[model samples]
Structure formats: structure tokens, C-alpha cells
Target chain A: MTDTDSTTTGPLGPDDITADSPFTLPGFFDALAEGRLVAARCTECDTQMLPPRPACYGCGSRAVTLSEQPRTGEVISYTSVNRPPSAFEHLAPITVAVVELDSSARLTGRVEASLEDVAIGDRVELRIDDPETVDIDPDFDLSYEEEWPAHVFELL
Target chain B: MSTAHLIAVGSSPLGKTDLPGRDLFSKALAEAFEELPDPADVVDGLYVGAQSERYENQIMQGTLMAEWAGLRNVPAERVEACAAAGALALKNAVRDVRAGVHDAVLACGVEKMTAGGTEGATNALGAAFERALEQRSGITAPATYALLARRYLHETDATERDLAKIAVKNHRNAADNPRAMFQQAVDIETAMDAPDVAPPLKLYDCAPVTDGAAAVVVANDEVAAELQRRSDAVRVAGIGSAANNLAVAERDLTFVEGANVAASTAYEDAGVDAADVDVAEVHDAFTVCEALLAEAAEFAPKGRGIETVEDPEDRSAGWTDVRINTSGGLKARGHPIGATGLLQAVEAYEQLTGRAGERQVADADTALLINEGGVADAHTVATVLTATDGGA
Candidate 1:
């Protein structure tokens, strides 16, 4: 077996990860795996944060709890990286986009399609893909849902 | 809202100065204090603006500057916001004096970027971006501005020649500035054909990483009246600041919203329009930044800033009307981040006082200074300065 193959596990098991390692999929990833996106809601300010931080950037309150988030979102803006860093060498010419979650929380991720199909206001859905094979893994992949087919723009 | 007057303006030689930011600051402070008619008088407060503490490893910079400048007992605070650190520090000093808390204060900005290598300094600047989203994506300041330059060219009629003309004009202006980092002139062709640092941004299009410091002493109207009896004084009419998202992807790439907001607020406070500005020292960290800022600040109409720079009629003799970056700006003046904002203020002080020998705008009455801390879309500060002896 090759080194690449050795690193590419079918699915990460609980024993293969740790809390300190960013690669260890956090609790949010567990929810994402179940098709339920999660965010953190501050108890004091009712502010929702996706890919949740330990404290609220808005009100600076640590009293926050995990809550379910809308899996659908609209693309706020995006850019195409013709050249990427070493770790993402395999992912050059990729389109990265900022998506405003249906709940109004913003998060960024790699859009898994041609750049032409993506644009501001394009609808996107959170989907899971094996992180081991991608150049820069975000623990999950993003793809357009079937219902928003007309909104997609094809990359030239 | 409060009245603050510039009593003294001085700088350590700005170039490839071998001294660190602290040392450069000390030299400039010594000169400023010596220039004061009463050098022994105690200052009520001190403010210093620095962009990065990661390289300097010196947190609590205000205390450090006060100690080094021999003002141990004075209350000192460091104001940081990327390149606009010094401008914001001056604004804070103005606020303190206006509130009747302090009558006299010293504001200084210093940056020692050369102590670290090029890559180290570049990475330190990248810290201003969103760590997880933008910085991690390999988007440095140059690349971010390059993306904007591309978009501006596509949406508007700007070309590489238009951008190069800004560099040529600033370089010629710098030739007359004795303290400018680059005092040599270059043709438009030389600027346009320089090596590419990032796509659409040539070597001449970017400011060099520099080490320098600038200081200005601010006082209230009473103190200003006293200073006028002794020497020339420049009065601060208005100050404004605005903050935007750290990530470039979050906003429109072609325009700077923070600059527009800050300029509008300052103009409103000064009760003057863009047409009234006799001279302006704007942030030109990149060539395109100056053009976009001119339009966004209403100094020129949208997409017409390029024409303003390129048109010979707009830059005729004895005209100097609406002069932008007369001191070469950060593009050729050297951008020692922390000191950049203060340097711009110093340029205005010199222009208004007729002390800027060769580069002086004839009979200047009102001047504006705009300083930005991060990339075009980040933190920005704008201030208006008027000659105390001159009229509206």
C-alpha cells in the first residue's frame, strides 16, 4: 500500500482522533454526519454562531449552548484560487465561497463544483465527503441541492 | 469635537534606517522635544501607534515609549489598528484634550519591520486577516489587492498604464521630499514594466517595508495660542474612524467602504467638502488603493480618479489643486506601518506651515490626511488639518 492510501482511512473512528487535533472532527462534525448542522447560541444575547466558538464574539458571553442550524444557505461571496498553497496543491483552481446560513450565521467552505456554476446568492447544501482524500479538508463537502439547479452558473 | 493644535512635528530620517522602531521613535521624540521652546515642560499624556506586537514582542508599547522618551510619570497608551495606528493615536489625543482632561499631549507612531526578514514581516501583516478563513487560504495583502486591481480593471476602464501613472507622479513628487524613502523619479514605462509581485501589481506598485518613526505634539487652543507666539502651528479641525470586516471576501472588492465612511464623517465635522481640500496625503500602500480611495472619498468621481492623475491639465504649474500623495505616500515614502499615519499628519503639518520646502503646495489653507491600517477593506482613519494663520 502507498503512503497516500495508508493515510486515507474509510471513516475516522473515535480512537483515531483527539480533542487537540483540529482534524479530529468536533461535536459539530458528529451532528453534520447525521445531516443535522449545529451552531452555538449565546444564552445572553441570542446570537447564533456557526462552526461555533467557545464564546460569543458579539456579547463576549461564554454561556452558550449547541443548537441545530438550517442546512441550507445562500452564497454571499466567493473567489477562485488559481494557485493554492502546498497542502492544497492538489486543489488548485478551486472555488471557495462564503455562505450565509439560513439562520443568518456565516461560514466558509470549498464549493465542490465548477466556478461558473457558483455566484452570489446561489443556494448550497451541506454534504459530507471523506476528508482524507481532499487537499484541504473541512470535515465535510458542500454541493448544490437538486431543487436549486436553476441558480447554478457553470464555470467557463 | 474638541480643538487640538499641532505644536511640533518632526521625524527621524525615513529610509533604510538601521535603528529599530523604539530607537527611531526615541530619535524623533528627542528632536520634537528639542524643537519645543520649553523642552523641560511636562506632557499630560502620551500615545503611540504600532501595527504588530508579534514581531516587536513588546506589548504595552505606550508604557515602553514613555519610558524610553524619558516621560516616565506620564500616562501613556498605545493605539493599534494596522497602518492607521498613528492617525488613531492623534485622534485619541484630540479627544482627551477636547474633554478637558489634558491640555498638552504627545502622539508618536513607530514601526521597526526590518529587524524581521521579509517573510516574517509579511506573515506578521497577514495576522490582520481572519486567521482560519483568509490567512489560512494563502491570501496576503498583495494578493488581496491584486484581486481588487483585476476586478477594477474589468469593471471600469482602468489599465496598467493608469496605475503606472500614479507611481510616476508620486515618485516625481517624492524627489522633492528630502525625507522620502525613495527620492528618485521613474518614468511611467519603468513603473508599468517592473517585476510582478502579485498579478497586476508590479514592484513599483507596492510600498517597501521600512523602519522609521514620526511624532507630533498636540495641544489645546490655549496652548496653541502660546505656541503661535513662538512658532507656526497647525490646527486639527476634524477626525473620524471606521471599521470593516477583516476578510476581503466579505465585502465588495473594488471599493473601500471604510474609507468612504471615515472621509464623510471627517468632512462633516470639518464642515467642508472634498473641493475645499487643498492637499491630501492618502494611503497608497498599493497603487490602486489611491485611485479607489479618491473616488470613494469623493475627491474624484467614480472611475475618473485615473484620469485625474493622468490629465496634464489637472496637474499644471502653480495649480497643485487637490494634490494627492505629494510626499510620495507609502508607495515611495516607505511604510513603517506604525509611523505611517503620523507621517501623513506630519506632511500636512509641513504643507500648511510652508516648511515642506520643495514639495510645498503654494498658499495651502486646508489639508486632509487619510490612513488605512489593513487591506483596503479594513480599519481606516481620516483627519482634516487647517493652517491656524490661514483662512478658509
Candidate 2:
């Protein structure tokens, strides 16, 4: 229990719902901070939810289990945010993409590449970095999110 | 079950206005109730759609707007679904009247998007996207839709120019609409050359941050007959709403399945088909949305939605004859977030009643309105309105 556990075989019960469980945001980030990208694999519909959740949206089932996800994926679609939110204004003209991981769990993240350089179907690798080191405004984080890691992608 | 009728509709000036949110609501309310009786006399319930408390730092909009309209006590409440809020308000009102809960209900929406400048508006709207993964990645409204546009172009015969033409067509329609924010038409070349808010989504491709409000009155059959002439009222024949994935990454990039479900549900409820619609006001918040929604609403065949720019005769064989965004849509009419869905209803009301002068479609008896919030169809409300006399 000392190590952040990202894998769980489920049909989870109320006792299993705690901060240390990957089903909650705190536990999900805890595992991510330790370099384990976890997803809630819905037993009912096989839908993969990144940063695991308690319930499955695909088929409305609560029988979700955690599985560590592969870091590599391909870009399904991409864009550049010329004007981003105020918290990320310093990083304007940010290139972002929706990447489907090797496990087929899709997530959107900032890409460490120029807008002109990325294309659909391009291979990329997910990278987790400490939030403070990412140059994002500290005010962007809520009190609980201050220590959470930020994710980005680099073209392969 | 009682029939829900849209008896009257009104809107405030749609643009950068000095008026605050409540005052804007007053403007819209004044017009809606001008010919009819006082709000309290005509309606027994109220619903107000307001997108954010960030602008003007206000909440309890339902109470505030109801008070502004001179209604003291009633079952008034606020509703929110980002951009789809306005229509959600109308849907609630319709449901109440149809259920015999209220003889009449006032459905209105207002937003003071200009209260904060562009930066403030950006941050306020940023709350609409999925926070955990999408917003953390710095995805703005245009950027998320750009993902859909980028993939749509890759999968279909649509080009950047084809998308630009959507802006052109909507602008042309807007020029003819007296209520549009941008009443000046832009050619395809200008739209194509516009600055990129996000790649695949140029400045013209996006709807402006507008300050506006709209109000619609929904009444039962008996109430409608007492308040207005039969020809003046439009029947709220059907309404359907759906919430899709909050994250844009998880949705179908090319097709808006949720909108399709909502529209199909509405079409079924109305006992009509896509072909029966004579005019439509789909959420053209972005140029690409017009095309995507046309396909989603079943007005155009799959991947041929870009043909929305073409005249009905010139479009694909499977395309419906419905003219889209005749009130300039969100692209030109002005999108004031919470007020947009009601604005679509305003346009439909005007068209169904033959009040749309310059941009009026011939025999536009049946109308469809699709209002979407968040990226793509994360939330969608589709309503169908038919002329009371069936366009006799």
C-alpha cells in the first residue's frame, strides 16, 4: 500500500473507494505521479477511461477495473490554440492533439511540437512532468491540484 | 396532453452593448410582452438561461430576470448547459405547459459576455470543456472544434475553401438580417484569408463574443387562443435533448451522433421527417458546425454536409430543401452563450410567422432548431416548430 497502485481487478465495493484507490482523482494523480498511467477499463462495455473514474460512461456500468496504460499512441486529430485560456496565455499558440494510446484509450494533451509539424495519424509518446516545472501559472491549480503532474505528448 | 405553442418571441440588440444582463433581459421582455398582457398576467412559471456567473458576477438569474419582468413570486429557476441553455429554457417551459403544470411559461436567456473583455470571456467559456484532460491541455472552444474540422476535412471531400464558403453563405444571410451582429457580407476569399483563431478554424469561422438576450412565450392551446391570433402562434411540435461525452477526444470527429439522436427524436415526436423542414437554425457557432449539423440533423447526406452552401437544387440528390441559418446563425446573428438557443427560437418564430422579411424563405412552415453547447454536440437541444395553420 506504500506504493501508488494503478492496477485493480474490480467489481469494486464501497470499502475499496478511498483516496488510495485509482478510481478517484487524487488516487489517479497519485499513481500518475509515480509514472503509472492508469485507466478504468469498463468490464461491461470495454470502454477505457483515462485517469480512471468510478463509473463507465459507455454503458453506464460501475464495474470498472484499473489497468496501467501504454505511453505510446497516434494522433487522431490535432490543432493549435492561438489564444488559450488566461491561465495558459503565456503558452499561446499551443499545439494540441487527441491521441489514442496503444491500449486504445484516447486523451487530449499539449504536444511538444510546432503546429506545422504535427498531422493526423502521427505517432507520439506521452510524457508526465511535475506541474511546477511545466511553466504553467501556479494560480491555474486548485489547492488539491497544486501537486498534480501535467501531461504532454512528443511526436515520435 | 396539451399542445405547447410559441405565441411571442423577442430579442435584444445582439453585439457589444453597454447594457448589463438584467437590462438586456428587460429589453427582450419588453418586446415579447408589448402586445400581450403583463408577464405575471400571461405566464405562471419562468425559466432563465444564463451561462456564467463570471461575467457581471451574478447568479439567481431566474429570480433576477423574473423580478425585472415584474413577477414577484413564482416557480422561477435558472438553467445552464453552456451554449444550449437558451433552448433548454424553452424546452422546460414547453414541458411545463404540456404537462398542465402551468398554463403559460416565460422562457428567456441572457448573457453579458462583453462585461469582461475578450480575455475574460475566454476564461469564462473555458469552464465548458472537460477539465481533467482537455482543458488542462489548453484547449479553447475554437481549438476543440478545429479538431473536428481537421478530421472532417481529412475524411471527406471538404476543403478549407469549402469551410470558408460556409462563413460566406452565413455572412450573406446575415447581411439581409437586420438583427445580425455582422450585417455586412464577406466573400469567400475574405473568410479564407481571415486570421486563424485555431487552424482549420479562421476568425470568420468562429462566432463573436456577443452580449444579448432573447425571450419566448410558451402557452397551452387554450391560452394561445386567448392571447394571440392562431396564425401568429407557432406550435412547439417536438423537443429532444441529449448529452454526449464531455471530452471532444472521445466523440466521433466527423459526425455529431448526439445531435442526430436529438434531431431524430424531435422529428419522430413531431411526426415529421427531415424533408419536412423548410428552414433550420442549427448551431453554426463555428463554420464547420453548420455542415456537421446539417448532416447530423439529416438535412444533408453524410460527408456531403458542406453542400449546405449550395442552393437546394444544386446540392446532392439526398439533400433536403431546407435553408439553413437564415437569421445569420451564431456565426453572424451573434452568440451570447446562454441566449443563443432562444435566439434560434426567435428566428424560427419569425420565419414560421412570416416575419422574416428580407431573408424569409418561401412557405417556411416547418422549422428545426439545433442548439449545442461545449465542443461539438457534448450537449444538444433540438426543437421543431410548425406553423399553427400548417402553412395554409
Candidate 3:
């Protein structure tokens, strides 16, 4: 239940501990490579962390486990970006969605659904990003979209 | 507690210009100083609220801003709080004067967005939101605000027509403002039918990419008395600032919580209610903001800010006495990001001093300026300003 011991593959010393210790973005990608979705879940209040953070946004609890994320969520909001910035100029008219996962954590990802099929409260499920399709756009520069803009949700 | 007053104000034109950011700031400042009798000798400190360094291709801009403005060796500080950067500078200036650190301070906010064009401006502007969550999604400010606008429509039984009312009204108001960036007034049809930037939001619904600078001299009692003979000063009665959770979803999507908190703080500090406000400059970054912030500031009861737009004179119901965005707000006054907050201050000063000409409200005694950063989330800086004396 302690954050110190919850990491699955981290090799930490007795005093060494970190939030991204075992759960880096690459690690999230690793899990996705294995067809699984994982996020930090607080051991105390059960607040789920997406794009995981070191300190818990709720209750400031650091004792959390990088557990399997909920497969499904509901669309909370969406915007169809017709005129994206220079980094995303090629991907104009893309629909981005903010989804609340069943685990109660929220993250933004592209919704692989038609504007007609998707809505504010529509159900969605996490879909892994395709390595072949994800071009590492250096211009976005440390943006979550740079890392996971293609990591998306499917209408369910 | 000691009080601070806005003794002088100045602004560069709010529109596309070839001037560099520093020159715009200098011009605005030069105009501000021109209003004062003792100019540089009176300023003990300076705060510059400039925008994204990416646009200007410069860093550590305060010294350069002072140098460009011909300011000689005054203690200077740079303040940046996204779109509220200017307001933050003003807030710090007021605090400095009230704390007896400086007798007179200059707060300047300047931004040159047109230099980079629309995409460049969009990228720089997008940095105002949470980087980890919102920015990476390839969302522009219009797209982000449109999300709120859409949700607002669903929740409030309001339509695009209601939002258009803001665009129409602000434009109408700005038509009388000579310094406003957009002087042409638009009807509801013009607003609703303007080319789409983001659906449910159109070109007219959003603020234009403006290049401008605004500056104000905030001074204590002694300096105010000295400057009183030179210009009409407005009392900085109360100022309030608050921040909402960075994650927009964590707060109510329908209302701007930061604005509500900041407005309440300003109201409490000023010892006045919504009834006392004669004129207001709400941050109308987008049309939805006009509605959301007016309600958040409690100028209109819940779900009723639309009435302030739909019918400006129909204050018979719960819609209060305040006429919001008397300066056309960001929508028409022009939004130069960091400069916007100080621009609101400039506008409020104009309205209260009876110098606003056609844009002037009759006998405006008290005014409020609500400036915000982020898309419905993040910092809201609200300042309550009262005229030194009742105006004609």
C-alpha cells in the first residue's frame, strides 16, 4: 500500500523513492506496449492520477500504486481544433476530448469518434497509441500531446 | 491601511502595428509620463507586465523595457501571470505603495502579438493553460473557450444568440472608444455568422490578435495629492485576487470560480456590493467569458448575465446596476495578453473620470475591473476603483 514499495519494476534503495520512479511516460508506453492501461491510485483516499503526479492532487498522499487504469470513461468535454498551432498544423480539424475514466482520473486524448457519435457525456474507452503513427514532434516540447496526442479514446 | 490611487494612465493604440513590443511599451509609458508634472523623479519603483518572451525573442525584458522607455535607474520588477500579468503588476504596485515601500510606482503591461501572426500568437497564448493537460491537446484559446461555451449552452438553456449578444454589445460599446482596436459594431447576425474559429464560437466571439501597451501610475496619499492638480485620480478602494484549480474540470464548468472568489474579495475589501458598481470591465476574452464572468462577479444572478447583453436597459429584474465592459472589454478593446489587465485599469480610469467621451457612463462613481488568465481556470484579479470625487 506504501508508494515506496508499490512500484512493480523499480530498483530503489532503502531511502530512495520517487513518483515517476517506476512509472515514467516510457513506462506507461511500456504498459501500453503490453496492451494495458495503468495509472497511480492513492492508497489512502483512492484518488486516481492520470499523466501521474508525484504528489497526490487530493489529500497530498504520496502512498499510491501504479495500478491498472479503468478501461472505460465518459466524455466530459470536447473541442474540434480547426486551427491548431504550428506544431499541429498538419492535424487540423482534429477532435480532442476530455474524458473522466471510471477510476475517477481525467486526462485529455483524441476521441476516435465522429462528432455526431461523441458528446459531452458519451462513454469511451482507452485505446493505445500506435507507435507507427506517433511521430515524435520535437516542437510540442515536453507536452503530453507530444508524448500521447495519438493515445486516444474510442466511442463505446 | 494606506490606500493607493491611479493618478495617471496611458495606452498605445490597440491594433496591428509595426512597432516592436518594447517601443509599444515605451510609447505607452511616454504618454503616461507626459500626464505627470514630475515624471521620472516621482517613481520609486516600476513593474512591467510583458507577454510571452517567445513573441519578442527576448528574455529578462524588464531592464530593456526600462531602457527603451528612457527610465533612469529605477528599481524594476517583471511580473507575469499569463493574461493577468498586467493586473498582477498593478496588484504588486498597489501593495508596494500601501506597504510604504514606494511613494509612487509605475505598472506597465505590453504585448505585441501580431508580430508572430495568428499561429504564432495562438501557440504563445495557449501557454496560459495547464501545460500537462490542456496545451498538448493541440487546442487553441478559441477551441478551449468553445468547449466551455458548448457546455454552457447545454446547461443554461442559452443559445448561440445569447453569446452573440456579448459580441454585439462590446462592439457597439467600442464603436465610441477611439483607442479601441475594433471600432465597427456588429449585430447579432454579424456575430453568429462570422467565420468559425471554433464551432459554437466564431471570429467575432473571440478577441482579436492585438498589439498594445497600457500603463498606470499608482501612488500613495502624498504623491496622489501632488498629482491631483495635474490629473483626476481614482482611489484603489479594494483589490482581490484568487486562483481556481488548474484543472478546469475540477471546478464548475458553467461558472468561473476564480472570478467569483476574486470578485467577492474585491467587493469585501471595497466595502461595496454589486449595487455600488456603476461601470465594469469584465475580461471578455471570449463571448462565453463575458457571460460567465458577469455572473461570477455577481453583477447578474445565476444564469442571467445574458440579460445584461440581451437587454442592457432591462435591469428591472435581478440584473444589477453595473454596465459591464464599458471599454468593449477584450472582445473589442483588443487583447494583448499581458497588457489586457492594465488596459482594463486604463478603461476603468477613463470611465470614472468622465473623460471617456461617448463611451462614458453618466455619473460613474465606482467601477470594477475583473481580469482573468487561463480558460475559465487560473488567476482572476479584480480591482475596485472609485473616483476621487463624484464626476459630472
Candidate 4:
């Protein structure tokens, strides 16, 4: 469980929804940039949500706490985007996968490998990259999303 | 409680059209109001379903569509749930009519998807997925559904060839449909040899980007009787919808549980069972979806949905005799995103009233429609319609 003084854990009220709270996107990405992958672990039902939110989807509870996530997970499913959106056309045929992290919080991200190399159950580790390093078209990024980082997976 | 009746339905030609979004809506509106009285006399309110403003760079579609329909003011608004926006509009209209809020309401949907070309359409549709994770990873509509398709294949005895046959079947069905975007039948070899849009999903497996519109007029029983004969009307017997997990990874990979809930709810509300449905038009954005939805809607047994391509007698024992996607589904009839769900209703209207010319299913008195938006069942709307004279 997350024990950092900077992050608060437990059910949040309306007053606790500030940008600084890990329940918000800004705080979640901020932690990721600093090498801390945080998820909101629902205390009531144990649902782990990546990009920590205020409530749990599992049991619809707001009684969630901050939980630092493990980097390694297995690929739950995999596919390749042969004709991607305009912003990512530069990276056509990008192999992407739905990965369940070691803590059971699942998310989707690009896999750093060819489609042929990746398979379901392949062990992979999450790697955070600065948004600028990814070379996504600037036009695709909304003004508020310009500074956000992108996540990718590398086969272990 | 008032009974909601679908009095009339109409659609613009489905394909890459040379019309603006409003013009497409006008075409549908004109066709819908053709046999009925003017919109000013027949309807009290309007709901417009539109997926994105990116293509036309416009919002306020509710006001725009209302004005075009010559409706001055009576609760005009827009409803959206990505591709399921059309059915969402219809649901709201039915609610209004059933609750005595309006005697008649117009539910319409429009999309000019071809305006942006392939890349622009791709970018616009990309907004439907969970933005923070999936979008950043470069996922598109086909790609997200491909994720579902991949896991489905891994767990089932179904093969890639089985998926190809779904395309072939829909194409063959489309060949007989006058309103289909693709009117020609394709062989299994052609479907199998098509270029891959995403692994496990080929070009043929994906629905085309279409420019189209559909309009449905829902009214109370009194207004329906005033407008048309009882035999010509179809009853909105039941409605159900669900919003599942936005992120693809978080939800069940194969079951499409949300769709199941929606379908089951609609069946219960309609006082009918899956076996009683003579025809169905489901969301087939991808070939795998047809199979997935077959099971979700309880028309086929689990892991045996691929038998959708076979004859009813040839399917597994647990499967129902419901005819799936007789309008060629989204695969060939054309998926105009915002207009798709209403298009399904249009086909149902045709079948239930005995107007579906060549592709008609015999004694198709009861019909089901399942429209979904986002990755699989991130949002779903299931509706059951029965002919007024068919024992409803």
C-alpha cells in the first residue's frame, strides 16, 4: 500500500478533488513521471484502477486508497494497429497489448516489439517516456494534454 | 403509462455520399415525413444523435436538426454515446412518449464520416476509447475490437476462417439489400485474402466509413392510430442499455456481459424470450462482434456463436432460431456511426411491418436491435419491437 506522505489514501469527499490529489489525472501522471506508478486500490472490493480515480468500478465505492503498482505483468491480449489515427501514422503497424500488471491493475499501451514477437502471457515491464520523446503529432494533443507522458511496455 | 409506437422510419442512401450532415438529415426527415402529416403537425419534440463534431466541426446538432424539421420549440436536444448515439436518441424519444411528456417525437441521427477522409475519420473515431491509456497507445476502433477478437479466438474453438465466413454471409445478405453500401456478395476466399486492418480483423471484417442519416418517429398509441393503421405500426415493447468499462483491458474480453444485461432486460420488459425473436439486427462493427453479440443477446450458446453463419438447424442445440443481421448488419448495410442504431431500427421497422422487400424474413413479427459504442460494450442499447397486429 502507498505510505507516501505526499499522497492521501481513503475515501475522498468533494473537497479532496484538487489537482494535487492522486485521484486526478495530473497527480497520477506526476507520480508516473517521478518513477512511481500509482493505482487506486478500492479498500472495499480490492479493485485496482490505473490512472487512479476517485471511485472503484468493481463495487462502485469511493473508499479507495493509494497503492504503488508493480512494474511487471503478463500480456492479457495483443494486437497491431495497421492503420492508426493520423497523429500516430508515423508509427503504423504499432503492436499494442492489454497488460495486467503484477498487482492486477490492467491497462493498454504500446509494446516495444513486433507483432510476431508478442504473445498472450508474455511477461513485460512498463516504461514511462516523456511526451516529447514519443514524437506524436502536436495537433493530436489537446492544450491541456501537451505535457502528459506516454507509457509503453518492453518484454522482460 | 402510455404505450410508445414506432409509426414511421426513413433513412438516407447509405454510402460515401456527396451531402453535408444537415442535408443528409434533411433527406431522412423528408422520407420519414413523406406519408405522414408535416413535422409541425405530427411531432412535439426532437432528439438528434451525432458521434463527433470533428468531422463537420459543429455541435448544437439538436437545435440544427430541430429547425430543419420545422419544429419551433418543444424539448429539442442531442444525445450521444459515440456510435450508439442513434439508439440513445430513440430511447429518449420513447421515454418521452411513454411518460406522456409528448404525443410524438422525432429521433434522428446523422454523420458525414467521409468528409474527413480515412485519416480524419480515424482520428475522430479514436476519441471513443479510454483517452489516457488506450488513445495514447494509438488504438483505433478496429484495433480495440481486434483486442476482443484476439482473446475470443484464444479461448474458443473458432478459427480465423470462421470469422471470414461472417463477412461472406453479411455480404451475401447485402447483395439482396437495396440500401447496403456494398451490394455485391464476396466469396470466403476473398474475405480471407483481404488486407489486414488489424491482425485477426481484415478490411472486409470492418465496417466502412459511411455518410448517412436515419429518422424514426415514435408516438403514443393515440397519435399512432391517427397517423397510421394499427397493422402498419410497430410497438416499442421494451428497451435496455448499459455502460461498461471504458478501457478495453478492464472488461471481460469475450462475454460482452453488458450487452447480455441489456438484452436480457429488454427481453424481460417485452415479456418475450430470445426464442420468440424472429429477426435481429446487432452491432457488427467487426466480424467478431457478430459472434460476440450472438452469445450476448442469448441467440447462441457460449463459445458457439460462430455458428451464426450456418443455418438455424445446423447451429448448436442451445441456440435460438433468430435470424441475425438480415440487413447485412454494419458490415454491408453501412455503419454511419451516429446513424447506425436508427438504421437497425429502420430495418426492424421494415421487417415487422412486412415491407422488407427481398431480404424479408418470413413471419418476422418480433425483432431485436443491439447497438453499441466504444470498445465492445462500453455502451450498449438493446431494443425489442413487435408488430402491433402480431399478438403484442
Q: Which ten residues in a row have the lowest lDDT in candidate 3 chain B?
A: B307-316
DockQ each: 0.10, 0.86, 0.51, 0.89
Model 2, residue pairs in steric clash: none
Whole-model alpha-carbon lDDT for candidate 2: 0.91
lDDT of each: 0.73, 0.91, 0.79, 0.92
Residue pairs with backbone atoms closer than 3 Å in model 1 (clashes): A116-A153, A116-A154, A116-A155, A117-A153, A117-A154, B83-B373
Predicted candidate 3 versus true structure: per-residue lDDT over B1-392, tens digit per residue: 57899998999988999898888887888778785765567778788887688787876677776676556788887888778889999999999999999899889888889887887798888887666546656778888788788788878877888888888999999999988998988888877778878878888889989999988999999988976763489999999998776756455678898899898999999999988998889888889988888788888877777766744566547777788887888999899988999999998888888899988889898998888887764788999999888753
lDDT of 2 by residue, A1-156 (tens): 121244455667788889888788888888899998888888788889876887888988888888788899999999999999888988888999999998889999999999999999999998999997787888878788888899999999
| Chain B TM-score of candidate number 2 | 0.99
> Of the pair 3 and 4, which is ahead by lDDT?
4
Instruction: Provide i-RMS per model in Å.
Output: 6.4, 0.7, 2.1, 0.7
How do the predictions measure up, each by TM-score?
Answer: 0.77, 0.98, 0.91, 0.98
Better of 2 and 3 by TM-score: 2
Instruction: List runs of model 4 lying over 4 Å from the truth.
Output: A1-7
Task: Report the TM-score for the A-chain of model 3.
Answer: 0.75
Greater DockQ among 1 and 4 belongs to 4
- Find the candidate with the highest DockQ and give its number: 4
Candidate 4, fnat value? 0.89
